[model samples]
Target: MYSSVDTIWTLLGAVLVFFMQAGFAMVETGFTRAKNAGNIIMKNLMDFSLGSLVYWILGFGLMFGATNGGFIGTPDFFVTGDYSSSIPSAALFIFQTVFCATAATIVSGAMAERTKFISYCIYSILLSAIIYPISGHWIWGGGWLSDLGFHDFAGSTAVHMVGGVSAFIGAKILGPRIGKYTKDGKVRAIPGHSLTLGALGVFILWFAWFGFNGGSTVSATGDDVLVSMASIFVTTNLAAAAAAVTTMIITWVRYKKPDVSMTLNGALGGLVAITAGCDAVSPVGAVLIGIISGFLLVASIEFIDKVLKVDDPVGAVGVHGVCGAAGTILTGVFAIDGGLLYGGGFSFLGVQILGVIAVIAWVAVTMTIVFSIINSTIGLRVSREEELAGLDIVEHGLESSYADFMPLISSEAATTTSTNDTNDTIPVKRVNSNPNAKMTKIVVITKQSKFERLKEALDKIGITGITVTQVLGCGMQKGNTEYYRGAPLETNLLPKVKVEIVVCKIPVSTVIDTVKKALYTGNIGDGKIFVYDVENVVKIRTGEEGYDALQDEAEAPSFA
Candidate 1:
């Protein structure tokens, strides 16, 4: 029997973790395009469902009962073969289910804006069913690694590290979002749609982590459970505070202003770094862990983006992979009982290192093969045309938003276009075909709600366009109204995005359909769409036109 309070808390924590699906969805969507919002939400939701079922049926036995088998579990699947009742198996399911989801969401951030929901759905099943569980079994199960006296109080190695590696593999296989990398190999800093939402999502995840780390204690018997929960709470907050401050200062010094996204990642990095030792270390130690983790996280994101040429859109690898590994190793050195830093010894560190190495090896090898197979067999990226347009319209055939960018407005005049009423002449940006052109450019103007699906729909067909600008205004209609500050502002023009679909006209209809379907918002504010006919395209390489223009012109939705 268990204490009701413990059970309640555990269940409450599980609920919070479940809500993290929403948090991740918001963060991923905010960081990427609005068109991919539904796709992201779909992926996050399915990830948890698939993760729970798979973890329940397949992962649980391998993780808990197989704790003796040194390599893999021979005991159970469906959690029945060695079913002996000593604990509330349901609680284990709740806690570990969150972990499986966490590992699954890690891939979401890495593969956002481009992955087909179906492909991603299949991968999610594999991740929860096979990838995360097997890696978890190696350390948390009575596997060879656990018997070596490895210590991961939480899941620095088992959950975060494993997820990180999987994320890396998925990202590599998916390639960067269309605009993430340039022809010249320059990394562009693409801003998220909603910084506030992204930041808020991070805070929500931070709050839910109390359940995440605290619920790790499966038994309610030990005072260590309470003590561990308290320690985790204190250290978790401190590390995040330190990380935010560190990242804020670093950004101010380096980039002239504090960046919200980096600060968010820094906070998460701190949490990740301290996760391995939250139970064993003091709050002060947690602060140190966060400070260093913040630095490392920021630095690693840059390194991965530049040196390794990996595109981690949401910094998933840096926050989880690099920091998770760092946290695990630090625990061996900082653990108070016998750490070298506290005059303990190097044995703990060595064990941690071995554990880290084993976890990394397993995840990297497994995910590489899995993703490679998926890519080779089922189609991975959409056709270049579809990519350029957007996945929403292409995959699901529905536009998510109608906000379109007014082509002629200056940056400062962006907000003013709503009031100015003009019906005759729409500000049009034309993109035509050239045999030698290097890229295709198209601007789509429609309702605010429909704008999101156009690009995604286009991308799915066969396009990977570049340099899309999201803006809001109107060309003909006097739309709704808004309250700016205290005064009521009239909403004449609705929102829209200027999709720069850069491709040869080989698959022009793919792009057009996304624009048309999503543009029909069934509202008066549902604005007009203008697809200007391209005139002349120039391919700088060969200075060619017509047939060769398309060969020279480049891809289709996102190019940094």
Candidate 2:
């Protein structure tokens, strides 16, 4: 019988899951360079949009239809099926559709920044319509794994692991982004552009996960069903919290401080780990799972980046694939019933291991074939020029994702200047050089924050018309060592401002004294000033030479 309450719950779950696309998009964009932000958004958007249409037309039937030899579902194209459920078939379809999109979209982060847009679209279609559904049938659609009593309540293996394994295969085939690793095999840290957006995305995913884990019950009527839903919610929250805390501590110990990005990944890793046994594990078990996931997240990311030499910008392989597999296997040990630790023996635990291994092999082989064929034919990665220039302009014709933040240039002024009479020449007057005036050029390299005060001090000492340029350098200190994503930057370069000033009438001692007064903080990084002798000076607008170029025609020198 169709139940209104159950139908409402399922629909609500679908909507929440659908919003996760935004979360994934924000996370991927923030973790990558600003140049590739638009490309990231397009990938996340199209994967869901395209995956939705294809999942409906073909994927739904293959995942939920009658079983064929307990391996694949009989093709029920267009979603015509009589799968037993209290919710309407349409409701179940939409709910499952979002899950399919989630699995397809996870690849966007691992292969971001350098992937061809068309290639990614094709990959999304294949993953949604074929790669996901076939394995989904084995776990959820009355296939061999389900018959053997493998427990994956909310798809740690079927969804997250499937996506994670595919991500690993695709990243391995695509190769690292340019400049990710040096010829000497030294790792360079390419930090994300925005941690704020990444944090927002994490919070959004955390909020939506309640629906993700709780909605799997698909019921609101009976006491047992309501209780199970509530338990799932609690376990999910506990696991994520425990994992985040654990990661913060681990990074603090290893990296000398807590890492914001890796800690966020830890929270996500906890969520993925708990997803497999949210319903079966106790709250304590959820925390234990989360803690384990935190350790795995840091270790796996380090191993993948340093040892395996894979360039995963968002740690997708670690948080999803590694933790997802660990979570599924942990479920066998933590489940209250039929668990190895619960006196049910090794049979159930063995089944869980078999399910994880089977899914990994299935996803690995299929994704390898998919990526290989794509690489050989239409090409999987973008060209060197397109990648260096960013996919936003070359691939999508977008100048920038943050175009509004850029400075506006006036085209009318540029046109007027370009069209001016260049052939006409103005009469020039050459002024005699002042032999007593020894023109001195003072170059000041100082901390960025001291620029305003330094400028004021220079003006007071009649040392105006200074040029400032932002630069990166280090003194004898060589800068303090810092950590990015747990990797130590031993030779860190600090940012400073270089101020250039040329003086003719003003005494060099006066200008130097003023600069020292303004910049001196009695600190190691107070900055230094270099004095140089200049041969001559020429003002471009008036053709004033030597001392004439350093002073206005109508004004007297402020200093002697």
Candidate 3:
């Protein structure tokens, strides 16, 4: 009777966990470029379908079938056994299958915007059917680790760790986004499209997690069951809250401002950290674990980005891998000993470390081999042309910004860029009121000292007015590199300032002359100047004519 009650509640929980695929899809697409939204959604759909179907065929039995002396289950391929009709059998397969698929989806976000659709599909199936199940068998399948009393009450190690590590490896193979790391080695902040969508997806995931941790208990009645569920809920919530605060505060202190995306990742870091021992840990323990996990996540992300030179676009490694390992280890410390709260010592802590090492080895080695095979045999990346054009139009032949392109918005991005280009081409609608149409205007990218010489050259050409902006970027000259985590992040370029000069239509050639003279400090990468045709201009403050408005700004921007 007790087993029957537990089984029913768990199956219900599986259903909730199953629905979380939608949340993952929305979050991944929202966080990446709109051009790749369709592709992202497609990968997610396939991951679950492929992961579950594969798991059902042979993965499930290996994970939880009758075991050989508690090291691993055997003879349960396709779930062929006398226990097939048992309640625990079906409930176990359903719950574990969801977790396997969830792990596979984590990679989708980290390697998004660049990975080939075929590669993603192939990896997704491998992760669920092969990667997730093998590790799951070790810990939860009554494998050797289970015999050693290794505990992962929820799947911090089995699901999150396996997924996170795979993501980290995959990201390394895929390389950074086209302009993410500049040629000079400076890391640039590439903001996601919508913060609102990212945040909303996080909230939905939080709601679904209750089912994930609660259903693991497999019971509706019993004091122990209730205690575990309530404890896990508290721990989960605390960890998420801790992570958000920790990231916000760290970023505020380091950058003098809170970074929203870091905070979002922080929340997830907290969740992954507590999953291993949520049921066993005390509420106070949860807070401490959560706080540490939150801080670890921020550090880990920076490390991975700067030091490891791994471009995890969405930071799945910090939120899942590091936090997962930390949580699983913490479980041994807190639950085994007095948990620092009940006076628990470091004995369990040692056990936790051992478990983490084993799991890491299993995942790292297997995934490396599998992915390397795919990389060597079939290319893993798409052509650079396809990436720059946006995956939607190139791959799917659909534009994500259909509305902006079709209906049109007066002040929208595309329109603004188009208007600027058109105005440049139709330049010289009328001669400058001042008869000096020969003044050459050059937009020079250089320093203040170097700029003055260009001004002198412009003076010779009768060029007038210049714009200077203090900016930082790379331009083929090697820039200073900063380390994030243990990776060497290299942009491999140099930084320079840009100077703009405007002259009469005739003197445009002179402006170029002045810039070339003033610039060129005999350095590898001093700067460059380019001229473009002028177009109609407008002054917001007053209805001013052409030259006056043109004088305000002279350079045409190459919109990225």
Candidate 4:
């Protein structure tokens, strides 16, 4: 007899899990450059699409079929074999399918930006169809780990760690993005374009996690089931919150400010850490697990980026692989019944440790083979030209993901200039020359915030025309020393605005005095002014020269 409540709960969980694909898409896109945004979106979409189909064809059987020597499952293609469960077979299959997709999707973030689209697609198929299922059998199915009393309530190891390990291996083999490191081994910070989108994705993932952890119960009718679901929700939330807070404090002290991106990753780390033990651990245990995860997230990211020199755009390996394994092992120390701290000797903890190691070994070796094969044959990464041009343009033919907001210029107009010069000649209008009216050019290099005030001051002093350009430079200061992902960054160039003005009438002293009065802040970065003698000025529209060109048609020349 199937319970409708259990069936509904399982399906609902599957839907929530499915929505995590969007979260992954948003997070990956936001953390990368806008040029690669479309490519990231496509990869996330295809991984889930391909993962779902492949999981149904061969993955389901290999994961849930009859056991074979406690290592693998009997091949039950198309989910044809009868499986005992409280919910319908279809419901259970769909739920597990989404879980399989989650693991496969995690790799895209680690290998983002430079990966070949076809190569990534091939890798996704292999992970979803073979690598994930084989190890999944060992834990979720009646494989050796499950037989030895290994417990992973909601795939901290099976789903998250598997993805994290694959991400590490893939990123390692694929190599770092261009310009990620200097010749002297100094790490360069390639910040994500938008934290707003990353934050939105994090919130979405956090919201859907309720189904991820709670829905694992696969039941809601019985009292024990209801209680377990509530506990899972509470533990899941507490862990994420605790981890976010811990990371904020650590980054605040280390980076001298709360790092938004790292702090967000901390929340994710907490969620991944508590996932394995949400049902078995107490609320207090969840909090402790979250704190540990927070520390591990920051440390792992720093180690991987600086020492190991692996480029992970979104910190997937730290939040998923490291924290996943940590959470699973910690479960043995926190579980109410068999936890070591709860008086259940080291036996259960030993098994937990063994499980994490075995899974890591399994994913590492297999994914290495998969990536190596892909690399040796069709190639795993894009060409230098293609990468520099961005995957969206070369791979997908997309000019830009945010095309509407950009200026509209056709290819022909952008690339080619007409050779015809029929209308190039303009009629010249010579005015009376004033030999004493010397043209002077004034250039102002100042803080960007001071541009408006300086412009107003110039306008009040009868200096109407000026051009401004945003530029980067440094003087005696040589910029500030900052930390990014725990690495010291010596900023040699700072942003500033350059204002240029040419006048044949207004005295240069008058303009200089007005600028100094408006911009004097007595600060280190106040700015500098440069004055130069201009030979002449010309108005292209009217072909007017010298002082006549500098004056607007409606205004009389002050020089006259």
Off by over 4 Å in 3: 1-4, 69-71, 82-88, 336-344, 401-405, 408-560
In candidate 3 the C-alpha lDDT for residue 158 amounts to 87
Model with the higher TM-score, candidate 1 or 4: 4
Q: Output the lDDT of residue 152, model 3.
A: 89
User: Order the candidates by lDDT, highest first — what do you get?
Assistant: 4, 2, 3, 1
Per-residue CA lDDT of model 1 for 292-383, tens digit only, reads 88789878887888777777778889889999999989888778876768987888789899989988988889888888887888866777
Clash pairs (backbone) in predicted model 2:
none
Candidate 1 ranges with C-alpha deviation above 4 Å: 81-86, 219-224, 401-560
CA RMSD of all predictions: 17.1, 4.2, 9.8, 3.6
Q: What does candidate 1 score on TM? A: 0.71
Instruction: Judging by lDDT, tell me the better candidate of 1 and 2.
Output: 2
Q: Give the Cα lDDT of each candidate.
A: 0.72, 0.90, 0.74, 0.91
Arrange candidates, best TM-score first: 4, 2, 3, 1
Model 4 Cα displacement at 30 (Å)?
Answer: 2.4
Our model 3 lands, by Cα RMSD against the true structure, at: 9.8
Cα deviation at 268, candidate 4, in Å, is: 1.1
Query: Each model's TM-score?
Result: 0.71, 0.86, 0.72, 0.89
Q: Write the per-residue lDDT of candidate 3 for residues 386-449, one digit (tens) a residue.
A: 9887776766667674445455446677455655445433333444454333333456676545
Deviating ranges (above 4 Å) for candidate 4: 82-84, 411-439, 446-466, 472-477, 490-496, 503-507, 513-527, 538-560
TM-score, cand. 2 vs. native: 0.86
